[model samples]
Target: MSKHLFSASLLLAISLVVGKSAWGDDNAQSPEPMPPQLEATIKAFEAIGGMHEYRECYGFPSLKFHFFGLKLDSTDADIKKMPVVPFPFAFTSISNSITDLGVAELAKQKNMRALNLVDAQISGQGLAELTHVKDLEVLNLSNSSIQDKGLEALSNFPQLRALRLGNTEVTDDCFVYVSRLKDLEALDLRFTQVQGKKLNELKPCEKLQQLLFSGCPVTDERLQELGKREALEGLDLDYTQVTDNGTKTLENFPNLRNLSLSATKIADQGLEDVGKQKRLQRLYLSGTRVTDEGMSHLGGLDQLEELALSETKVQDAGLAKLSDLKNLNNLKLIRTQVTGTGFDAFSDVPLQTLNLSHAPISDSGMKAIAQIKTLKELTLDHVPLSDEGAKQLASLDNLTLLSLGHSNIGEEGLKSVSQMSKLRVLDLSDTPVSDDSIKELAKLKELRLLYLSGSVITKDSIAQLKKALPNCDIQSDSK
Candidate 1:
């Protein structure tokens, strides 16, 4: 079974513990945190409402910051204390705090690869000092005060690869500076005024792999030109007016791997063009006009691994049409009409992860789910899973995670769950598991983390359970 099964589960980790998240990577090499200084610095920045993503870059984890979340009043003097995050603590960002003086200070750092100042009130002339960071490779000036002059000054960084100018004031008249870049791979210009002939001026950018334009005035003609590019791998056209004409153009993209068409005008027929792409792996069609008939076109997508049909028209009958998708390991059916009575739709299917939270699967309907034997994780939040239906899950011995919170599971259900003993994470929060079932939970000494919030557990019961399962990180802190 795939390790991402619990990724869509309603169970959230307590975050205080250093264990596997109930809904994230289970095969953790090591669920380790950064060093004390690095963690403190990140927490300090996060305290000011900065959102960031960290990834391994050249042997060190680098951060990508979004400065739009910061208040407009944030000053260069206050933001100038940019942490000295070197390779091991590499700090990359879609936004950063830098001035002419700040950029001069970065010249000493040799390994800095990416710099950003998004939505910040920095002056356009401040970019003149950016030429000092000679080793920089990625730059993001999205939603900043930078204009044609500041945007063109970026051509000085010959090694720059990924650039984002989304929501910027830079116009089509100044695209030559961007199109001339020799090694640019990923370019994001979403919400910019780049449309019509404005996009064509950058036809020289052939090495582009990912082109993200969500709110730009993109059309099928631009998409058709993109389809002809052999190196383009990812495209995000969410919230755009691109219809089936634009989707059909991508049917023959040789290397397209990830496609996001969320909130678009694509109906059933637009997906027909998507099914023809054999190399596609991840497809996001959330918040669209696609129905069950549209899913029929996806039956031939044998190579697809992840599919998101949330808030679509895919019901039991429509979902049944996807049984032939044997390679499908991840599926998101949130806010749909899947009643959970059609286990046959998943029969013999290698479904490692499945989300049916927003559906109307009753306790009796959950009986149909017993057919999935290879399931390693199961999420039944907001369902009608009572003691009877919860006990039926003991048959799935491979379950490392079982989330039944916000349901009707009581003492008997906990007893039934305790018998399995193989579960590493259990979420009985928001249920009626009372002190009477404390002993039943205590039986599982191997449990890593348990959520008993909103349950009728008492301090005495928590003490007893703590004594019974000394290793478990019990979250009986709530009612």
Candidate 2:
């Protein structure tokens, strides 16, 4: 689905660095010649209209694809008569192009494996055409109108491993078909008409490791069905009605590493079980009822790397229990009751990214975490800090991103933040900083994104800043 397969992307990024001059190594003796087969593929891609040239990285040969823009008479019938492109991947803005005849023609290319028709007008009849694609593995039909009967066509895809039907019109009746895909490993049913009890149909999907039901209308009883699954590794039940009892169902996942319970009704009763998941590496509990009592249960999660407890009832005492999690590198505590001594918890850890936005952190509270020399990104949005507290951030040499939005931090206080030469993204929106402080940010040559909304900067000032940092994306609330 990406430019290349997941393993291929990784290979290109880190592993494929020794062989070719494409790796861009300075001491290369000769330029590696492209293979004839690969050259033919490139020629085929160029033969198609609106194709972009490939760029190599990390010595990995770039994938070749074609793009055809606004074809004046593009239609489903028009696409049916069109010939298969020279390459396996392509992007075309053909209106109503997922019709049965068009799909039949596209399926003739046995080499094609990944296709994206997101937000297309494909209906039941049109979707049935996908049954012909035996080798297609990744299919994205998000935001389509494909319904129950149409879903039946996908049950037989031999190589279909990843399917996305999020925001579709199908309900439990459609899930009955989804259950038949035993080979399915990743499934996203978010924002759909799918509801309770019928979700138990997923238990039969033995190979399913990643399931996202965010924004689905599911109850505790229905979600508990997941307790029977042992292969699940990533589960997102965010914005569901699942309570502590439903959270217990996740205990069935022995290999569970990534779980999101954000905006649920889970509290201390469930955290005791969550704390026992020794293999957990990432957990999100934002917008839940977790309190200090629940925080005590999580002290044993030494393997945890990323944890989000934002918008909950966790205070200073609760946060103190998480200080020893040396593996924790990312923490989000937005709008929580954590403040004052709560800030003391993170000073001992090597935190690289922290979000304390919408909390009540004062100058002294801000100083507590300044000792966290490893902090690379920090968000103190709406946590009003005085000028002295703002200056404490200057000691953090690794700070690359800083957001002080609505902190009431004035231009004088911003003088200290302006000294963070390594900062690439800065959010000073909704603050009292004016032109004087705004101009100081221009000195940061590496700054790429600057948010100036709700500040006193004018359109002319933004224009000048844009000119100074021609490549930076500087946004202001001029409108």
How does each model score on TM-score? 0.78, 0.81
Q: Residue 371 in model 1: shift from native, Å?
A: 2.6
lDDT of 2 by residue, 1-479 (tens): 11111222233243222212111132212224433455555454454432322322211111111222112134455555444444433333334445555555556555555555666677666656656666666566778767878878786476666677778887878778888887777777777876766777776688887777888888878876565677777777888888888767766788777788899989999998888888787888989999988987888888888899998989888888888888898888888867656757676677898888888876777778787889988888888788888888888879877887778887667778878889877777777877777577787777777778888887877888888888677767764
lDDT of residue 344 for candidate 2:
76
The root-mean-square deviation over C-alpha atoms between each candidate and the true structure, in angstroms, is 6.5, 7.8
TM-score of 1: 0.78
CA displacement after TM-score superposition, residue 155 of candidate 1 (Å): 0.8
Provide the global lDDT of candidate 1 against the true structure. Answer: 0.66
For candidate 2, the TM-score is 0.81
lDDT of 1 at 101: 55
- Among the numbered candidates, top TM-score falls to 2
